[model samples]
Target: MGFDARFLELHAAMPRVSEADAATSVELDYVHFSVVLDTARRLARVTGVNVDGASLVELDRGGDDWQLDERIPADWQAGPAVYARNDLDRGHLVRRRDPVWGSPEVAARANAETFRYPNAAPQASGFNQSKELWLGLEDHVLAHASVNGMRLSVFTAPILAAGDPAYRGIRVPLRYWKIAAWNSGGELAAAGFVVDQAPLVDTSEARTPLPGEVPDLGPFRTFQVPVADVAALTKLEMPELVEADRLPKTIAAAGWRRLETSADLLL
Candidate 1:
């Protein structure tokens, strides 16, 4: 129920805390995480999910029942109405496939946990070139994991910025981030990425709220940024995880790579 020991085994070790406001720690069936309930926003500033790749079975595409976490006050998290008629998608921070690799019974439970409203975030409604790349990064890593014994540990959350556009009582985060770690030949290695949905998101305060409509702002951009930079932007203390980055310390000197496909990923 806590951060799974299996997660630590895959991360090589636990990284530092990412959010100072994490007021609640909730352990799901297969994942362990903490959330900062933004009472004002009716959402989370940070909802960190730790997943163990070894426990993953196959991608479960079955129907999901999205529910509010009874473990916490329902008002503390977003509900389905916020997404109604809004051009936003209820994105799963812990990719549904990541936690499905266990026994049929165990995997079924984990798959269901992935749908809780607390585990969901508001994302730009539709996919674009950048969104596709961002969504596929995990699959690419998993493919490479075959050589590393198919193991991984991932951390993900929306970049909850004060400047995000407010709509229907919730602020729409313009960006999201992910940090994936794995062990290779007895050493810890990790990669950090950020996906910007800014182009498709309208921040104008005067815009009318349309629940089911998302503007086509154009193709989004995905970047392979420095782990240190991710830590700074998200306010997550990830010193050890940053130290394990495969990218050059001078990520700027080399320039962050614009990811177009899995082949473009550094890891």
Candidate 2:
């Protein structure tokens, strides 16, 4: 699908992005995203999504139905088989609610687009409470949207590292990252966060746990870090977004701020 030019206006401006290695771009109706699948790893190099808050709707969550994007070969994307017997959840890269705003029909189409496997990554299903907090990061920003013109764009994807553990022919990423971009007083602004599920995923080839072992492997942690760090890790062109980070300029001099609640966010 061709990317919508208007979607570009909804996000923080950026430098011309160099093509990622063996990347595949899939642009949805209201949500513009790109999928760079690592066929060997059976996962995405990065799935970048741009969402417009003004077009969002308050619809009830859709049925958790997942499908593969027919535009791409079925084998190129991970299927339910990889997640079936594991604790890994098919987590959405582009949040389920972000694009579901707009007219009823438009909202429905965008909602369905979010279910494609290209937009999902394997995440620790055990981080329930922490996941809720991570999901609400945009809500916290949306709260201030009314005053800031209701414009918001978020970029998210798993940190696909080469050494990630392989399972069922797919390598499960240990961490995931998100950057919320918006306009505050006509100035571009953004905040970066990382969710580490390392403690929760057992990447070892042998999946069996010892008898009588506890199943849960949390509590996961989320931290607010510098946008430059996210750009460095994902190797995407985020110069403008990095400059838009809401953290103090001296943040890198310090360290990533650990977040326990939405209240800890800078907005």
Candidate 3:
């Protein structure tokens, strides 16, 4: 009931935190995914989920409850306190519906497991508008995989840069990264993306907020980047994914490509 490294025809193992932070990191397994929490930072360093598009279950998100995993100390996670009375939304790193597949019982469990605090990250509420394009990337990729066995493996996490703004005892990440993997005619194919909300986030106010003031956030800028760039930005090991990247070297050399719609995707 956890992230399966062998889910894809070509193995795409979960990303690892750096050696310096490894000791303090806690790996937690959920229904169909796993989260590696950076205890010191009180946030997830990386998460992975296996997606089966053809067998997806459409579960209603009526309850929408969030809870701390008892397996880890509550302080190890960014709980409700970090998001209360603020514009920050608890964004799911693994994406709630991505792992909701298989039998009814199993699918329901996967849905509830997504609400765990370890799977969430702080994101601007208004960032949703721009996030539409970002989220659509997942749908587009899934649709592409549907024709080729409808399976995918996804890895995601906040950049967790050292310069992130500290607020409510936790640092708010300004950037997030996602990578999607699928089998393309017997070979592994991958696409990587990085989403930035730094322009929307007023870190100065966050660094020194008045008693009730929170960081101000606006829109998000999404970019389709090279897998190597994602590894460099997050300091994670992903040689296999980097080698499997579908982005052309010419396009990657030019720089991160901005995406206004799914049509802009090179994949």
Candidate 4:
């Protein structure tokens, strides 16, 4: 739907963000995916639309030339720029050019929000490219309109640096991801999943885990969340709502409530 009310109800805790700003629009199940992230990590993004049904659309933004913009929580902070050193390109979830979304500015923001190093997986440039199989799945899921309430899932585990506190719990160098979304009761609903399977990549451990104890995230599961929700969760931290947390929320307090998927049909 153009306006997502289900998203609003699910992510009421997060500040509203523009479809133009970087963010997700819905949550989905991971087990249903051919692959999944086994780690006990979480990624709650706010869902938005960018069409790529015809083909993969790579963003025009790239390193050095690309600007870094973010809305961080005042009390929380990062130790340093993690992805600064590496052949890893800033990968994005929301493509900047999709027919559903007209202007490049809005898609730029959505792609930007997912640009965080935490949201990235250590991939060969070929693997991360939009034309690749993995990225193709992402576009398919994003463009899907399930006939039933069933939807796909999309979630990710941060690829951490070796010896860093965040990697201590990780048994595998590969990260995790899940995605799912569809329509219900005249509104669109979404869910996300996590499982101990299908590691997307294998690289040297880049970070240390907390207390040096590997975390068991249990079995694959699901949760409903808004499309605009993006919490600064690492491999260790759990996600929660902050009354006034900074984010794209820094832009303004606007969110979709009972958002309409097909405004023209509804009208």
TM-score for each predicted model, relative to the true structure: 0.83, 0.83, 0.94, 0.37
lDDT of 1: 0.68
Question: Which 10-residue span in candidate 4 carries the lowest summed lDDT?
Answer: 29-38
Clash count for each candidate, listed in order shown: 9, 3, 0, 61
Compute the lDDT of residue 224 as modeled in candidate 2: 90
Q: After superposing candidate 4 on the true structure, give the runs of residues whose Cα lies further than 4 Å from its correct spot.
A: 1-59, 62-70, 73-80, 87-89, 93-100, 108-131, 142-173, 184-267
Lowest lDDT 10-mer window, candidate 3? 200-209
The lDDT leader among the candidates is 3
Residue ranges of candidate 2 with Cα displaced over 4 Å: 1-40, 48-55, 144-147, 200-218
Better of 1 and 3 by TM-score: 3
61-138: candidate 2 lDDT, tens digit per residue: 668899987876788788888778556688888788776766788778777887888778887775466678888888
Q: Mind giving the per-residue lDDT tens digits that candidate 4 earns over 193-221? A: 22222223343642333563332222211
Off by over 4 Å in 1: 5-20, 23-40, 44-55, 145-147, 200-218
| lDDT at 21, model 3 | 78
* Stretches of model 3 off by over 4 angstroms after superposition: 127-129, 145-147, 200-208
The best-first sequence of candidates by lDDT reads 3, 2, 1, 4
Per-residue lDDT of candidate 1, residues 172-237 (tens digit): 777888888877777778888988877654547445446634433335689998888888887767
